[model samples]
Each structure stands twice: as structure tokens, then as C-alpha cells.
Target: MLIGYTRVSTDDQHLDNQRSALRAAGCQRIYEEKISGAKRARPELNKLLDHMREGDVLVATRLDRLALATRDLLELAEILNRAGVGLRSLGEPWADTTSPSGKMVLTVFSGIAEFERSLIAERTTAGRLAAKSKGIRFGRPPKLSAEQIALGHRLSSEGTSVREVARMLNCHHATLYRAIGTYITPADSN
Candidate 1:
């Protein structure tokens, strides 16, 4: 049995071309989804895997359509191999896992992909460290400005109700409390 799998990254993309090709390839069953290949879980692919039996062939239009990551592809291949199922890619002849040469090619590709990912991660970390050293801040900005915090502290010291001060500053009482620290007692703050 030749089982096909088709995938598109988003709903805006059509699966017609892949489906047509899979059909032309004489696929009796085809599983498809419109979701990012980066995602770890794919329901349709899982279903196909569960449905596949020994001596079956899992076919995809392209290697990327089947899996975006080398680890994921290798894991899928392992599962198929364990089930005595073969894998074939219509676009990449070197991706056929049924042949020894194809398997060797896939192993080399996986190694290259892993190395590429590590390099990307290393560069990203280096970039982040450089930016941080240059005083570049990341994540959400502070809710209250320095001036507002100073004003809040002054208002709290002057015995004004925290709620009233928060209202005057157009901020939540909790925000005022966080900015002003524990300056106001709970009874007076709330």
C-alpha cells in the first residue's frame, strides 16, 4: 500500500497540487493538514502512522512537507522502519528510505541540518549577549515611568489613599502598590 501525506504551512495555501501529485503517484490513501511543519504534533500524520501496516510505503510530495526538522524526520523514519514501512519523497529521489544509498543520503542530510541548527542557535545567543552588553532591553517595558513612580511615592508619603492616588494617576491600585513598594498599609491601600 502506497500511502501519501500532504502538508501546507497555512490555511491560505492550497493542497491541490500535492494531492494531485499523490493521486498521480497511485496513492490509495492520502493524509493531509494545513499546519506548520515546525509544530511537533501533527494529527493527520499521526493517524497515517497509526493506520500504516508492514510492507506499506509512506509517500510525500517533498521531504520538507513531511518534516521540517532533521530530528523529526529521523524519528519518523525510525518509526516507519520499526513498523517495516518504507518512505519515499516525490521531489527528492535521495530521500527514499527503502534503498541503502537513499538511507545514507538521509543520514548525511540529518547531520548537516543538525549542524546548521546549532550554528543558528550559537549566533542568536551571541547576538543577544552583545545587545545586552550594549544596554539593549528585551521583553515588555515597565508599566510605570520613573516620574510616575516618584509621584506615586510622594502621594503615598503625603497620607493620600492609595486608591485615590491610583485613580489620579489613571492606573490600577495594584500597579500603584507595585511601583510604590509596601509603603502603604493594606487597610489604607485597598
Candidate 2:
């Protein structure tokens, strides 16, 4: 028996591709869901897992569609492995659990996914550092400019409290404070 599982992260995501592929693969029973991969509340997926029997094969369009975390994949695979069930992924050429070589392939696939994730993290960190060196701010732009900042400093120095300065500037006190914090020189504050 071949059972298929299809998942879409959002309702807007189309399941046509997965369903078509699974149908072509001769899956008699198809389970589907429109929920986030990050969530653990997949009743359909759970039911499918519970319904699988020995000699049954579970099929999915992609390994990622089945589980978001590597731990999740491992746990699910362990369940299937223990139950004498098999898993087949249409997208992953190596994810066929019917043969010894395929089992080795799944192990290697997990390692590659882990390595790829680490490389992505490293590249993201390097990109952030590069942007910082070039003085390109990463987050949201500051509300105040140099002129407003200078005015905020001057107003605060002239015995005007933060509250008064913010009221006069028609902005929030926190915004004014943050703007002031950006330009406050250590020696000048002393």
C-alpha cells in the first residue's frame, strides 16, 4: 500500500503539484493539510502516520513538506523504521527507504541539509558584517535626521527636559530619547 502526504504552508499555497506527483506515484490514500510546517498541530499528518502498517510505504512530494526540523524528520523516520514502514520522497532522489543504499542516502541527506544550513548561517553573518563595514544600516531607518538630532541636543542642553523637547517636536519621548542617544558625545555628557 502507498500512502501520500501533501502539505502547504499557507492556504494560499497550491497543493496541485504535490497531489499530481503523488497520484502519479500510485498512492491510493492521500492525506493533505494547509498549515505551517513549523506547527506540530497537523491532525491529518498524525493520522496518516498512525494509519500506516507494515509493508506500507509513505510518500511525500518533498522531505521539507513532511517536517520542518531535522529532529522531527528523524523522529518520524524512527517511527516508520520501527513499524517496518517505508518512506519515499519525490523531491529527494536519495529518500527511498526500500533498499540499504537508499537508507544510506537518507542519512547522507540529513548531513547535507545540516551542512547547508550552517553554511547559510555563516554567509548571513558575513553579509551583516560586510554591510556594517560599509555603514549601511540593516534595520529600520531612524525617524530623525542630523538636523532634528542637533536640535534635540540644543533643546535638551538649554534646560529643556526630555518631555518638553518631545512635546515641542510633536513626537514620542522614546523617539526623542533614542535620537538623542545616537548623537550624545561622552565628553559632552560629562
Candidate 3:
């Protein structure tokens, strides 16, 4: 059994061409979807996978139609292999998991994709380090400056209520407590 899967990114896009091609390629049952490939969940694709069994073949018009990312494509291939099902792409002959050459090609592609991901990670880390060296700070700025925090501590120590200190500093009582490293106890407030 050759089960076909076709997808278009948007509702406005048509699946006629993919449908005709899948039909021509001898697909017995076809599942069509109009959804973004970037999305992880596709109802029609899930249904097609569930419907497939051992000795069944899954066909797609193109590799992009099945998955946008290399990792996703490899994962789907692994799932099919584990289930004793084969994956075939009409546009990409090397993606046919049923043949030895196709398997070899897929392995090589996986390696390349992994290498690319490592390179990206290295570049991002280096970029962040460079920015930090240039005195560029990340994340939210402190709510209170050092001078403001010292003033808050002084006011709290002088029997001022947390709410009154917070109002004087133009910040919340929680922020004032965090800045001063202490809350005003009932004895201190008195």
C-alpha cells in the first residue's frame, strides 16, 4: 500500500498538483492538509501515519511537503523504519528509505545538519561573549540605583513604614524591601 501525504502552507494554496502527482505515482490512499510546515502538529499527517502498517509505503510529493526541518524529516524516517514502513519522496530520489543508496544519503545529510547546528551554537556563544566584553548588558535593568537603595535602607532604619519608603522612592513596597534587604517589622515601624 502506497499512502500519499500532501500539504500546503496556507488555505489559499492548492494541493491539486501534488494530488495529481501522488495519484500518478500510484498512491492508494492520500491525505491532504493546508497548514504551515513549521507547526509540529498536523491532523491529516497524524491520521496517515496511524493508518500505515508494516510493509506499507508512505509517499510525499516533496521533502518540504513532509517536513521543513532536517531533524523533523530524519525523525519521521526513523519512525517509519521502526514500523517496517518505507518513506519515498517524488522530488528527492535520495530520500527513499527503501533503498540502500537512499539510506546512505540520508545518513550523510544528517551528519551535515548536525555539523551546521554546532557551528550555529558556537557562533551565537562567541557573539554574546564579544558583546559582554564591550560592556553591553543583557536582561532588565535594576529597578533602584545604588543611591536609591542606600536611601531606602536609611529610611527603613529610621522607623519609616515600608509603604511610606516605597512611596518616597516611587517604587513598590516589595521592590523597597528587596533593595534594602529587610522588611519593616512592627517594632521598627513604631
* Winning candidate number (TM-score): 3
| 79-134: candidate 1 lDDT, tens digit per residue | 99889999999999988988999888877876887798899999999999999999
lDDT of 3 at 66: 92
lDDT of 3: 0.90
Writing each residue's lDDT as its tens digit, candidate 2 over 14-37 gives 999899999999999999999998
Error of 3 at 134 (Å): 0.9
TM-score of each: 0.60, 0.56, 0.70
Ranked candidates, highest TM-score first: 3, 1, 2
User: Which lDDT value does model 1 have at 98?
Assistant: 85
Clashing pairs in 2: none
* Local accuracy by lDDT, each model: 0.90, 0.88, 0.90
